[model samples]
Target: MTETPSREHRPEPLWAQAAELISEQITRDGLTPGSRLPTERDLCARFGISRVTLRKALGHLLDRGLVTSSHGRGWFVATPSTVREWPNDLESFTTTARRKGLVARSEVLEQLVRPATLDEADALAVPAGTPLLVLERVRFLGDVRMALDHAVLPAALAPGLADVDFTAASLFEELTARGVVLDRSETAIESRIAGEALAAKLHLSAGEPILLLDQTIYDADNRPILLSTVEYSGDRYRLRTTFRPR
Candidate 1:
């Protein structure tokens, strides 16, 4: 009987070969993320291939998450978003954005001090009616809107928080300056559909799938200090972790 060939033994297709050449060119040309690639006609001529073959090559890159397509605008290099936390690393949004060579930004939506409700008090292990600070922001990576962040904490723990402008600031850094360094976080993730108002803010259509990350961050004393919630576009975020078997 004739033997079937394994995937590893198969010859690379022309489209895949084109993809490799294009990937190398992206680096050689110094096209950073959000930069548009050369037009399809130019790529076709340079690769000596038909438009169909060039499209196939581009499609490969799209599947690899290396590029994104804008309607009527062609393909652009894409920077992956960081909505998922690194296991055991209490990294902040600005930290992750810097690591990815992107510009991080925030638009403050709401910030206020209010008395803690029973549920909020229970979550932070504080007594009811305790004064708490609440903040809501739209977070961005590069020029793309990435996630919406909302956080709550005891007002006394972070003084002058209301006076700080969050648009160009990092809450983690600000908290550290106030002597409230976060030590760890207990996180949970869930999937949900984006409703009308939420969709408008994120530039997504209603009913789009979104990822919700709910977490409570603690200090070195093991006391929960911040209750945070983030909503991420489904295609833009991924949570990763590792478990060591005992």
Candidate 2:
């Protein structure tokens, strides 16, 4: 006798099935942004799934940036915002920004080879006075100008990058296309007033508050690939995180 495949052999989870159904509904109904979703009980009954399974599916939508839940209210479809959050296994800035429905645009202000300053050498873990490739850019979210990113790459690595259009794409993304393996990143964030040049790029008045992020992206072998500093305008940006104690 031939035996049927076990339930464990199913290709997708209950939540995944539920997520697809809800996703299809959203698409079919042409639900505009900020539209409220159905109740959990309604969803469970509609999909013929258990409450537990239905919730699992809702979780998938939340992870996909498609929906959000509230305490008093139920789930609602998300509207695009300038809020930036890091994704799990985030590999590129352009990819991350685009996922949030923001157009990732940049303008290269400076691209040249220069000797690393004492601080730059310390941050990059290279010899003092080592030559480094520097690319300065202003990053925009949609039509709103957001941040000025100053990126420094080691001279010991790809020296041919000076000719690339940094404004057209991200350096990290371009490096990956060249078969470079970037494993992880170290990021530090703080807030400060914008300098004169930064103010002009972000169209900010003097002494305005700004969020400053310093990021170091490393390769698979824990070698530092790029050092970057990003400055964010005050009114147009915010950062979110979920923390767990060690």
Candidate 3:
């Protein structure tokens, strides 16, 4: 009688297996930020994988923001402390920074009264030619510039808003003092790569990743009062929120 053939066990995908092995090695080695990873040749030899597979694993790490690559240098671990938790709240950037014991300040870049753009008009539910007060400011944490904020609102809704010293005060607080009661806000977050002007303003290299927050603030009466587009340096901030079961 012929003996039954033994079944073969398939292994995991090479790239995925390599990624897992590298991650384990990173943990076991206690590799700190800026620590250079083993050369690709060594890693390939150790993992019994090809160069392409090793690169795929490294690419996976890079996509997760766990590693970074220099032009001529190999991949290095990213700094964990560089990441900050940002909650999904309606608090002003100034207030959030202050709560964290960091000095927060703003530099007024542009302030003008102009006609609303088509997008702005739609967002504020105003006519295309409606007058709007636009304020652009750069936010700083201590000496490091962290974010750029562009805000627009109906000029008629906040009379004499142009007279306020926005660089020295919180826009939210100023609006509150002006009788604008903000009850809630809707926000959309996205990722983008910095362009020339934005890169210079944020002190980052061109094409660096950044976080964009487009939000609309509403009053207690559910009237939209303000539209803001804020860009934050990605390496310096992380969005975090808690989820609870209903």
Which prediction has the highest TM-score against the true structure? 1
Across 145-218, the per-residue lDDT of candidate 2 in tens digits comes to: 66788989886577568888777777877777777777887888788987777877866655777898788888
Show how many residue pairs clash in every candidate, following the order shown: 0, 1, 0
Local distance difference test, each candidate = 0.82, 0.74, 0.80
Question: lDDT at 224 for candidate 3?
Answer: 85
Which runs in model 1 stand beyond 4 Å of their true positions? 1-59, 68-77, 81-88
Q: Model 2: runs farther than 4 Å from truth?
A: 1-89
Order the candidates by lDDT, highest first — what do you get?
1, 3, 2
- Candidate 1: worst-modelled 10 consecutive residues by lDDT: 1-10
Model 2: per-residue Cα lDDT at residue 62: 77
TM-score of every prediction relative to native: 0.74, 0.63, 0.67
Q: Write the per-residue lDDT of candidate 3 for residues 138-212, one digit (tens) a residue.
A: 887665567889999999987888888887689888888789898998999999998989988876677888999
Cα-lDDT of candidate 2:
0.74
lDDT of 1: 0.82
Model 3: colliding residue pairs = none
